[model samples]
Target: MRIVVPAGGIGGARFLRGLKAALGIGADLTEDDPTITVIGNTGDDITLFGLRICPDLDTVMYTLGGGINESQGWGRAEESFAVKEELAAYGMQPTWFGLGDRDVATHIVRTQMMAAGYPLSAVTEALCDRWRPGVRLLPMTDDRVETHVVVADGDGGRRAIHFQEWWIRHRAALPALEIVSVGAEDAKPAPGVVEAIDEADLVLLPPSNPVVSIGSILGVPGVRAALERATVVGVSPIIGGAPVRGMADACLTAIGVETSAEAVAAHFGPDLLDGWLVDTADAGASVEGVTVRARPLYMSDPDATAAIARAALDLALELKGDRP
Candidate 1:
């Protein structure tokens, strides 16, 4: 089966491992691989040290490819900071964002590829050539759409900062008055993105941060339309009025959304999501248009994560009324 998974960082990457395992088991295949297509969020992309660093995309790529720092949930394993330290010694500013040397190598390759007139989708495929993640990973768009947050700076004035700066540097301490995808208005979806959604047997939205991650990816031209027309299911990132991880509350609040499953469902609405999966804890959250199923949502371990993965797909299948 062809599956199109729209995911963000960390949580999205973790669920994929289970999904890969489940598909293998279900098919009775030795090699647990599916024709998976991942539409990764590029909102976390930041230009640091004159290189474009896509954190969410890299997180998914490395995690699935066995190159990620498992504990940190991002960046490379056995990472070194030699380059960062050297740059710091030269008195570089904005040292708040951690870019290790190995991670820098990724950025370098991405930059060089882009400079060679390749779109981000093509560049990512080329990079994944070595990772062999057993899936086709595509950026939502190759356009220069950046997610920026309007926050109150230290000067007691409001200004829009890059999503990375708002999330990493200040750690979402400051309230975000606005979130904007700077180039989304004109950005078109990547080459295979629309086709993947249009032809997907199932579309899964993992428990990724809603606002900047999935939301930003959706901000691109054709994504929301594709989801609106596809067999789509979304797992809640917010459980019991709080996110299981990350500072999603800040971004949710920025758009006047309360940190609740109900609010998130309203934010995404039925136009995009056909089935919505929440934790058994938030089973009471039901709406008119979407099918709501309750189950454990925490990825505390592989078994637990796999259960949620099953719940997510099972709910999708139940809604679609398909055994496979």
Candidate 2:
């Protein structure tokens, strides 16, 4: 089976790990695992200390690659802060975002690759060559596009802020009035992205933040249009009208979106999603053009995450007609 997943940072990476375990247990993927391709959101990427930092890309790389700090689900494990200290010693601006000494090596390599005439998509592939993440990880766009949050200033003035600062510095404490992908209007999907989607038997949406994670992926030209032709199923991150894991509420509030499973489904819309999985807590939530199944969406263990992933794949296979 060929599978394609559009994913975000931490949430998306974790779900993929579970999904891989589930696929491992099934007959479809054993000696020859299903060909899985991931189009990771790059909107949260930022340039820091003259080095390009792709948070979502690195999150997927470290997690799927096995170097992840399991507890944090993002950076490297057994990491140090020596470089962070040195940078801080120089009075660098906006030092709130933590960068580990070991993690800096990744940024260094990526920056080097980019400066040597490679797009982020190419740079990501080179990095993944080391991890052998078991799936083809591609950036949403080779072009530059950053997601910025429009927030209300203390003086009542509205201004756009970098996604990293909004997420790490203030921790999404302030209300975001709007969300924008800075260069999406003209951005094209990276090479091989369309082919992966076109040839996939099924497409999965990880339980990532909709506003920036999946939303940013969709912002790329032809991404949503490609999904319009593939089988798509999404696991709800919101268990009972709130994110089971993160501060998704802050993201939802940005565009006046609600915090319910129903709201999340609406955000993606029935036109794009063939099936939606929600927790048992959200049973009977009607989502148009999508089959709603209420089950446990939490990944308490590898077993639980695998089960949910299998359930989602089964649903996608059963509802292939939703494809255009």
Candidate 3:
């Protein structure tokens, strides 16, 4: 089976891990194993200290490659912050975002590769050579697309800030007037992105932030159309009235969408999404023209996450069978 997943950061990475387990592949994938293509969100990409930081992509890579800090769901395990401390000691601005020494090496490599005229897609593939994440990870766009938040500037004015600064520095406390994809309008889908969606037997939208993560990928040209032609199912990030993790509630609110499983499904709509999975707590949730199934959505552990992934796979298979 060919599976394509459009994913974001921590939640998406962990869910992909479970999906691998559900498929009985894990890291022992062979030539005959099912192909999993992960279209990672790059909206969270930022350049810090002259290093290109692809947070979401690295999160997915590290988590799957067995080098992730499980407790924080990000960064490298056994990470040290000597570089960050040194930079802070120099009075560098925006010190709130932690930059680990081990993580910095990855950024340095990515920055150098990009500087040599390599596109982000190629750079990602090169990095994956080391991680061997057991999946083909592609960025949604090779162009420099970034997520920006519009917030009050405290002088009766408004200013746009990078999504990272807003999320990490302000902790998203400032209400977002608008969440903008800075370069999405002109950005083309990264190589193989459209192909992965169009040719896949199954496509999954993990329990990632719908607004800035999957939403950003959908913003890329031709992506939504490709999804419309496939059997696309999404696991709800919203469990009941709240987000499973992250500040997704804030993101949803910024877009004027209620943070509910049904609302998110409605937001994606039936034209793009064929199936939706909600937690048992969100049972009875319904979206017109979409198949909604209630399951345990909390990815509390590998076993639980695998079961949830299995439920999504089963739903997709059942829906696919009925397509004829």
Q: Who wins the TM-score comparison?
A: 3
Between prediction 1 and prediction 2, the one with superior lDDT is: 2
Query: Which segments of candidate 1 are over 4 A away from where they belong?
Result: 25-33, 154-156, 322-324
With a 3 Å backbone cut-off (N, CA, C), the pairs that clash in candidate 3 are: none
Runs in model 2 lying further than 4 Å from the true structure: 25-31, 321-324
Q: Which scores better on TM-score, 1 or 2? A: 2
Q: What is the TM-score of each candidate against the true structure?
A: 0.95, 0.96, 0.99
Give the TM-score (vs. native) of candidate 3.
Answer: 0.99
How many pairs collide in each candidate, listed in order? Answer: 0, 0, 0
State the lDDT of candidate 3 residue by residue for 83-127, as single tens digits.
Answer: 999999999976988899999999999999999999999999999
lDDT against the true structure, each candidate: 0.87, 0.88, 0.95
Top candidate on lDDT is 3
- Residues 8-92 of candidate 1 have per-residue lDDT tens digits of 9999998886787666532223343467789999878888888989898889889888899988989999999999888889999
Ranking by lDDT: 3, 2, 1
Better of 2 and 3 by TM-score: 3
Model 1: lowest-lDDT 10 consecutive positions: 24-33
Residue pairs with colliding backbones in model 1 are: none
Which order, best to worst by TM-score? 3, 2, 1
